[model samples]
Target: MLISDGLGESVVERQHAVGNEVDASVQGIVVQTGSITGDVHFRGGTAGEAAPRQLPSATPHFVNRLVEQDALTTLLSGPRAEGAVLMSTIDGTAGVGKSTLAVNWAHRVRERFPDGELYVNLRGFDPVAEPMTPNEALGFFLAALGVAADRIPAGDDARAAMFRTLVHDKRMLVLLDNARDAAQIRPLLPAARDALVLVASRNRLDELVVREAANRMSLDVLDDAESRELLAHYLGEDALAGDPEAVGELIRHCAGLPLALGVVAVRAVEFDCPLSELVEELSGERERLDALDSAGETGVRAVFSWSYRSLSAEAARLFRLMGLPTGADIGADALAALADRTKRDLRRPLAELLRANLVEQHERGRYRFHDLLRAYAAECAATDERESDRQDTVRRLLDFYLRTSARADYARAGGDSRGFVVDLPDSSIEGLVFGTDAEALAWWDAERHNMRAATLQARSFGLNEYVWQLPRSLMFFFHLRGYADDWIEAYTCAIESARFLGNDYATAYLLFEMSVAHYDRGDVDSSESYAAQSLPYFEAAGDTHGKTEALIGVGVMRVERGDLEDAVKPLETAVSIGQERRDLYTQGASLNGLGLLKAKLGLFGAAHAHFEQALRAYREVGENVGEGFVLHHIADTHRTSGNLEASIEAYRRAAELRLEIDHRPGAAASLRNLGNARHESGDLTGAREALQAALGLYEEIDPDTAAAVLDEIEVLPTS
Candidate 1:
């Protein structure tokens, strides 16, 4: 039976289910009903009144996933008797054929649903526009279901309810492909038991599984046989018949991923190279990933590029910057630093990347790239990103690390001795401002690998100043954390870069910093060599501060080598030069060195005065780390002078200030000193408590110190 209505006209016609016929026409409209069964069919009508057939054609050369196909069929069939709407979610990683399976299944079953089919690419993972809103999806569904434009509700909930009401009695097949999540798909679901919905997504849609009772099917990379069959279907049996081994190698290289296989097959057909030769070219991980490109946008990188290009500008920029890190995953705060964007400002752009499936949020507030996608993003940066822009972005990242790490070092060490000469570039985003040493150390732990990579990257680009400054900024952190290898590698690059730029001041500063790093690692000879190299450069640059710092480095190395007399001479010279210039940092540093020298020589009163003067200078300069150091030194002088009470009080104050700054290592040192003072005073219980706390802090910041503290605690009196 057929019925048609147009502009206040009606026409009807009916053909016999057996032999009967019926027909009716009014103006331009026609309607017919089968005389035997009373079934009506409309032949002519306004297009709006007719059932909409919106299903896209099924994918060609689709091969194998028979199990998934069967599972879907069962889901639809099982739910029919319960009078409940059948909804199945197909979820998987990108290019895993979720969309293909959903669409193919929809086409296969279209005949069962007499009301016709509906389709929409929800574009949940599309990089271009925002994910389809529920209200928008409902409106599209309503129009397709023959609801007038004006009648559709304006609000999302109202539109959804209206859509459900309209589809309540009809048997229809609806395909919601590439949906972002259950929230976006909920409003578009039909209420009718007779209708079936099939959705595809990269996410599992677990909410739908729990709340809506959705039948879920997860798609995985095809099996070897399935991948082979699919490839043969595309390239023809004849093409693959000659070299079975090469075909197997090609499929293995594709990792049974359907998108990769399709891309490779398309290229295999277009090019004349033997499949074996192609496999050889794609053997390398980087080249293999890149080789999956097809001209029709089917290549792995090309497909990724399409998704990448669809992202908002900020999200796109973030995606490209993600390639800068060599780590497997990154926290958002580090990513914010890399992009020079505030963490708050990055939330939406990061969410956009998640929606587009360009990046995955594997853990709360942490994201990672698919291996192939990372390579693709790197390619995009190399090709599309301007050299100047890349350099500027990299500089911002390096500057963020340097400035923040310096702040952290000051909190921990009581002073930063590297002495930056070049002014840092202005940051577009507010850099991290750590309130505690713990916060700063945590940030450093997270970004250590990226920090190392940035130094090398800067060196490669001849950003000489950054190459030197970045490593210098990291020195204190490395010393406290005992990262000797990273310290040496970074300084090596910085030293070469400083020499390349012919900046005598930077060269001297870097050399002094390298000496400190090596000395911390117990490489006394290397430390002295670097310190000796720095002295002439400091003199050449006419930098009295640099000269003072270099002299201190030389003296400290001599003290470590047990050349007490030689150490005394350079240490005295540094103090004189620092006093002449009124360079507070260098002067305080030199005073501390002289204090240590005096203490080594058992000149307790002289050491006390040197430390007191250093403390005053450090306070004048607002260097809390320097104050902590001098306070600890004063405590040592008091202890050596047999004033246990004074030494205990000094250590307690140093520990308190160091802890406030989150300086775990410094706090531990003070606590260790305080414990010894308490033990000397016969306060065993107090000694134990202080020693245990010190051990815990040491364990987190320096395991070697923690072990020594443990030995000290074990030997203490239990009573």
Candidate 2:
């Protein structure tokens, strides 16, 4: 604006400088908010330029969000401070339709921004791809603002500066949707108060609210009425009207999530089936998410995938593993245990999941999943994580409840308790340690359902050790708390797992424990029968340790039957073994029972002790991943020593980690090595299975290397 003293007002006016200051030394030309009396008028420079209409197609069937739409209108309809950009962070859980709302509202009010609306997906949460960077977004905005690709600046700062200058005076709506964070949207801001920016993300983007004074409006899952309205939008009112009950069930299944409702609606429209049939298909939690897939990006699972994939590896793993909890929510301590990490170590990953809106922490130290999201996460666990790792996570989860139950039991009992307690894993998450009786009881009450679920889940996974041990750990706790049904139900489950194992020692031990369970419930006849059955097997297995425990049950029956002399020897033997506190049960896993299970599985002799000794050491310290490598080594050693069967078992030695390592891939080379050993040992079927599995893994992690595994599979005898 600095010029010679005689310069005309038209000179400064043509430059779009609004306001006036007459005292400047270099400028005699000043433009003011004044009425001009001359025949000439000042006008703007940007005439006949093309206004960019860069917004993507807005959702056509958008309904509901009335409150949100109204809020946006009010926030954006008014004037703003000069150079103070208007922005609102539209954030919420994934698939809550943040982008859909922002776009439709923009189109509704696009007339105000006559220069045209500018929009970019930002792809900050693309399921399979990395987020678009600020430089990329800026380049996008510049190009939309009519900047040529070749003319675009090379640096982020320069491109951003150019974008601001280009849109500075224009009234426009810039939508930065699915943004990863506030930083990604900042540089794309036009910085003109007249321009409005709507930043949509799964995160709240608090920094934008604090620093930019950005207005924030978070979307929640629709209510029952809103969900029904949304369904009508896609399926039409008659389809919903045909079956009122199914409508209710369908809405419940969708859990008020708009994406799910929309997906279900589409399927409803496409199938032309009775709404009840669709309800039947989605009845099961396991298959509900499958039914919600629209076969595109907007599918419920696909939308969740975008947010899930935005996470770091640690956060992604936490998301999947969190799916394992059977309870409605998990405490921080249990999550740490499931992850084999300390609580302090889990904060970052937990925060990461929170940022991604993958999980919600409703209360302090407690987290839960959205119902549909929990299902999706469980599906991810089943598909994305190794079965072995899943098993390990559950195992650790079960162990946390089992071990902490024992600790709580001991503390609540004033230092005297019944269940067997192991030392907390040194390097792994040490389960909660209670400082008072009330603390122990409170945790027990809160985790009661989780522990019950753990027992059933263990048996279902065929984790026989924990199947029997968990109930045993809580046996006294249940009886003391008068949970008669829990005591009976859990012991019944334990007995089945023990019998299924067919280990005489383990079977007898559980039978003996069950007798006490019956005794606690005052069922003497059932107690006596269980005792008599247990003693024979204990003696058959030469388990003097277990036999002694059974003898007490026998003596109890004999004393009840009025036969004192016959009970004398059983009493004597019980007394004799009672003196041996450090028996097989107390020392560790009874080698006899373990040996029997190993024998049944055809992994006998030479490698048994080595696998047990090494694996026991690793697992005792809570090092499952480290143990995988060690087991691989042990298999290599067995193969070198020519014990092909043991070598095969070693490659498959993921049992103790309490997970099905199917989710974790053993190195393709190692799996191929196991295949060759199985072939050498005349186990053609086993060899073929191992090679095919290895080939499958390589196809994912290293397709180039998969050829060798394919060749290995091709050479196998078909027989």
Candidate 3:
């Protein structure tokens, strides 16, 4: 019932000699089991024929869920469920064992469905990962159901329909675990009457119960007996036999929560300490609800406080400092910077917290607090730590995020010609190191929520410099990853920070970035507004690069909005300014904007000349991606001018250059254009090859683009 890490079934290996006779010169003679067989053939069915068995292993020492388990079984098997899909939602507060119960019930019911089970941690409340969207979850389901990757639809609606169709007659168990809301889980449900879906969440999915007729079960904390039983199960009856009174007190202090009891039990066993000592500590922590918790009598803060108080001084300090940042989790390196300790010195303290369950090592090396635990830790920080110390901790933490983000930005850009520099604090000088763009991106993806939270925290603390710089540092990553909401939010914060600090230079820079972000999100009006607003500040600050950037932004927006006449003057002015200052980055960007305008105006020769100039400037600064952009534009001009051969060559070169810098979306676009150009030239074979490659890349990053490309591919000639 439990899913193993490897493929569900083991593969058999057999060796057989097919040739007629073995030579005497060979080392050994072959033995025939029965008789020589005729030629053997291997037949292939659809790939991934077996449904995915992704259920996590059930928890060990699961205790006292008899009534809840029986309720679930009755819901699943009752006669009222004869012809309808059974949907059950288990909801509870943090540390209430919702996921544990879900997994346990799922494993028990594994045999009820002939088709295998599928599970995903939606990470709805995860501080690090954004909750898994319905579309992404459906894609995973479709793949697990053996749908060929290329056959999967590129939109959520189509994918959902396909998923419903695939599971229509099949009896399967679908588990949507840790869902944030009904919307995230709804599209992933199978429409079949025979299939059952189980959802688990921290909040009650009222909509699912009301709209979808889901059976809702609200799991409360364990009762005193159940809590005591759980601890006894983990620590053995003999361990509790000597001090029944202390065990009762421990159970009372744990507030009947499984997670809290488990933490206390782990410590009781690890240190071989008397439960009476832990009880005393819990009773000694001022006996009040933690600042973050509103629960009066059922406070888990007492348990958290007791465990926290038991940690070594070093571990306890690190735990309080971890509360300073608003990020959901903190990486070990960032933790070091926050504590002003080296990575080597952090291992033992981190390990200490991990052992006590004050912090969880979620991913391999990254750690986070449970939402409740994080609140408790923050409360400790506010009550026990000095205000100045808290501010210093926050500053160090923000410094780490900003400096690391800047380094990642530089790495991803492949070296910037803008020559912008971030002055990191001495403590942050040895922040996280990334060796490659891919590594940098991976770290960014993991830390994105933390970064956003840290930015907000900086602003809240009146750290204006960090407020502006943090968002600026993250701009490249956010833009490249297409996080429009986060990009806009961070930029808005940065703009306010700049204004508050009365720094026109920073204001101009952020406005320009915001314009670009808005443009990327297709908000042309806002993009133009921000772009126009940036010009005056740049002029007042006498920042030529800022001025040139604003001009180019305005020009690009005008061109995109089809105002060619208005676009030309600003672009030309930007180009002139770039030339005067010899700023190659700005010059290349402006020339590219002009080329786009000229191309749109049907001045192909003029467009080609501008693109050529842009390419030369980009290459002079070693900006391969910028050069690729210019090359693609040049190819567009060539195509418009009816020079098919030149267009094809230019597109191919552009695609290659983009790929060389790992600009996959850019490469995919160039390849798609190349395919269209080749098709126009009657090269069907070349067109199909290029489009197919482009489609693969598009599917990874932009499924809507992939869908359009698929339509184009379908219209191409096959012969």
Candidate 4:
């Protein structure tokens, strides 16, 4: 029989015959159900007898940290009394000292709970073993409460019921470490209105508050100061004081995680070596996480093993697979895709790993492995994950990104009204959804760097198709980010791949992208040569769009070289062809190029008309970045013709757009243009201000445009 009372009380009494004999034991509130030979008795201990003495382990050090003043304030003041479930959760990557803080803070506040203290290691993410069952935990708690085996309930359900009943009305401090979930922990909760329960787990256990009304505490990694203090504890004050520079490097190598820093310090102490030597070993990122650990209990791998041993097979496998992704952080949806499973199917196992503390969710809906944990996961994947499987996973992920980027780029490039689509072998992952166009753009913003790395990786893997398409999809990001080096590097690889594949169209496209990179980087001669290289291939392949883009670039290059007459024919022809093909964006770009050349040729009125037309087309298409360039060209025309006020207004508008898009280099250029306009207008104060800002930008980094800005500043008549 199973019985549960609403007010934290439950009872179960049962009897059985073993080989025609009776088996029974009773020492508490005994009732005989069947064939019993004993009565049960339970003894409760005094509160003073329950508290254990502090062991002579390493001294618990307090490293000063910027308390997330908000979380600290909320925790310290929000719900002070007991029935208030103070569900404070500290979440971070492994080695971030989540457990240490919890333990330290619990000990600091233990005086509030007068009855006694109880602790349990739930082993939520042990790598090699299953989490402790509720029965196993309940047995320990029962034993702690002075309930003997002979008198204790035989079943977990019964034990939990009695455990809660026993703790009711007693103001005890319960610290549940590495709890797997609310369910594993719910049965272990004391029902006393005044009892305090502190449950620590890596997961964002929203289920806790929903079920138990527990208040939450989220912990983050330590800052530089705290990280330093942690290292000082093991390395001693003198070593750190002798070399603050080395100390900073040491803290940085530890990645501001207390556990990692402590382990590194412990290693330093064990080896009896100079701190600078250890710094050199940790400087290499590939071996840093591994090198940070030394022998024995204090080592990071040992600390990690404790949590790893508690995981079931499924969770352990998922943990290993997670390290294979190229991304630095992962969302739930992406993680689900990576594991080839539904989020629903994976949630329980993920939660179990979180409980065991092997995996930590960085934030709500996102997760990342600890540096050391990631290293271990990488090691596991290298051995456990088959080579073919690993290759397949990488290829699928690369394809997913390539196809999605192509879709976004095609949409932005004003393709047909139909949405972009890619077929996947698995029907479950057929479509990638974006909430809005802005959301799609944000995805590019987040993934631009990773995509650049992917392009290089794809080329290294000899994926020729991906090599060509990556540059195609990455045009907007390359242009917007001003990553000239990465743009050139990606295209250089694509060029080699295209030649290898003997594909004329791919060669033309790669050459075109390479030309853009050179043009942006002020290598006008190389830009023209690359552009000329694409012309013959485009002509051979009969690709008009490629031919038009290459022609426009060549015209722009000639205009930049001061050959305005030579620029006129190609610019006009490219504009006519692009307009005839109804490629409005391309036509606008061609007209903008022609306008700049006209302005240089002293045709102000014609330049003005062309700039206005280009501006309108850019604005109509919501191409803010392109519109900014057009507005700057218009300003340049006004400045050339001495229309100072109009030039100032146009320059300001261009600067606004450039700043909006985080185009720092472009903004600097616009500021220089504004200085030129101010000098022409005879506003010396404003001119000097603008010129000084431009000079400051130039001094910080030398770019091609900076020389022109310096000439303008130098030619300004000094007061």
Best by TM-score: 3
lDDT of 3: 0.79
TM, every model: 0.56, 0.40, 0.82, 0.53
Global lDDT of each model? 0.75, 0.68, 0.79, 0.67
Worst 10 residues of 2 by lDDT: 584-593
Per-candidate clashes, comma-separated: 29, 11, 0, 32
Runs in model 3 lying further than 4 Å from the true structure: 1-57, 73-86, 109-197, 235-255, 267-285, 288-296, 414-416, 419-428
lDDT tens digits, residues 200-232, model 2? Answer: 888889999998889999988777898888888
> Which residue pairs come into collision in candidate 3?
none
Better of 1 and 3 by TM-score: 3
Query: 407-464 in candidate 3: lDDT tens per residue?
Result: 8888777555764555544553455679877788878766766787788778778888
Candidate 1: regions farther than 4 A off: 1-255, 258-299, 302-352, 362-367, 381-419, 425-448, 475-485, 522-524
TM-score of 4: 0.53
Ordered by TM-score, highest first, the candidates read 3, 1, 4, 2
* Better-scoring candidate (lDDT), 1 or 2: 1
| Model 4 global lDDT (CA atoms, 0 to 1) | 0.67
lDDT of 1 by residue, 472-553 (tens): 7777677555456568878898888889879887888788878877875679989988988999998999887788888888
